[model samples]
Target: MASPLLRKPSLVHEGDATIVHQLLAQDTGLEYVGFKMIDLKVKARYEETLTDQECCIVALTGRITVSEGEHHFTGIGTRESVFEKKPTDSVFVSGGKQFLLEAVTNATVALCYAPSLQQLPTRWIKAGDVGVERRGKYQNQRMVHNILPDSDPSASSLLVVEVYTEGGHFSSYPPHKHDQDRLPEESFLEETYYHEVEPHTGFVFQRVYTDNRSLDETMSVEHRDVVLVPAGYHPVGVPDGYTSYYLNVMAGPKRIWKFHNDPDHEWILARQ
Candidate 1:
């Protein structure tokens, strides 16, 4: 759960992109997360100490140079990294604010600060490097992250990756809820969806609602439109005729996302 007082809100606007963030948590003492549109011609430097919380530094447009305690992580070409980066285990925390140097020609970067670190495993894989899996419908291709293997039930998560359909396909289909703390059933985690759409095109529909008489909300999202998964059966909907891409960042107390499927669509899980 997020602390209300620690919740800072803002709009991150750059050329051709806008990211709205509902910062549910922050570094132990820092109350505000950062959002900026920077330029390479001018070097940008930001420094802050982190509490127990973790932070995500995304190169919304170009590359960045990060210096942490006795280590430096270089992010090139619109790359991103968690402030407290974890290279192994798929789920772990470095737990610090650290410093960053952004030197992109013209770029917009989003910095997400949370109560703990949630960083994903990343490895560069070329096309044809591995056999592709046809796990989804529509034109969407599936390329599972090679770094993510089966983890312990007690582990924490950094990120989840999925390729969105080019023309109206579904990710997180059939609607499921991971808000409750259960044993091997569902785990509670807050998530962030970062998007990358095809040239001149954007995304469409995403629904978040509750089954226990809670109100539902449908949002028309575009590139970089971030939706908060706050205790509900949420589903991602891609409209017909446009290609989309996204990166999912998640973290919670349970450290696992155990879910209870809606009875209506429970059959889908069996197929997988």
Candidate 2:
């Protein structure tokens, strides 16, 4: 039997005939985070109104124009491919805001969502505005692009980021969990990982497990697959010869993020 946490890619045609893969939220048992992968052709347009949630639209590849009310952002993408190791353009739309996305070229986008009652101003997050950092060392090394973090007040609850792991590397390692709402100690956040591999045929391994081993599952993730982490210590490992890229969306009752690494594996962090 396949793990319920792993969501395989399936096409759902929207009104504009855009190819969309709905991943998190919507009957997935996740309370906060929701995700969708959209593919659009040149000149294609998709309009939407976020009634009760805030959204971050990430341009994964190619170029696109986003319009919110009277304001329009033209030619808002930079990277031609995610593997280019460059930060791409993104837009943040708060609740009750209506927006339109028009593809300037064939493009792929990620829509990350979190419920919110507060209506914040719409902001275009340029590629240059994204904070890029190289995290970990040696085999655990990975590149991180912070599209929207807790420090950014632009969002009410949504926290978004993307990570790139080299082949034979580990990501989200040392296994951390944020399932408890203990304020400064840890926060209860629901998270979703949308995976994409460099060589489409390659695969990666992700494990979601709790302290008791009651909720434990190791998933063989493929291109465009999404893994949901409702509550657990989650870690990812990339096989040799296959690079792994994942876009993460997280949210909780509190907008802050505080995680606790698994004690058994915490020793790895102390190693020189």
For 1-272, candidate 1 gives per-residue lDDT tens digits of: 43222222355544333435534343222222222223332355545465565544444445555565554555543334221111211212235445544453444444544444343222222222322244554333333332221252221333333344445677666777877777687777665555555543565577777886474777666765555565677666666666655555555564554777778876765663
TM-score of every candidate relative to the true structure = 0.66, 0.97
Residue 106 displacement (Å), model 2:
0.3
Least well predicted 10-residue stretch by lDDT in candidate 2: 15-24
Give stretches of model 1 more than 4 Å off. 1-42, 78-93, 108-112, 117-135, 138-163, 199-201, 269-272
Best by TM-score: 2
* lDDT (Cα, 0-100) at 111 in candidate 2: 91
Positional deviation of residue 189's Cα in model 1 after best superposition, in angstroms: 1.3
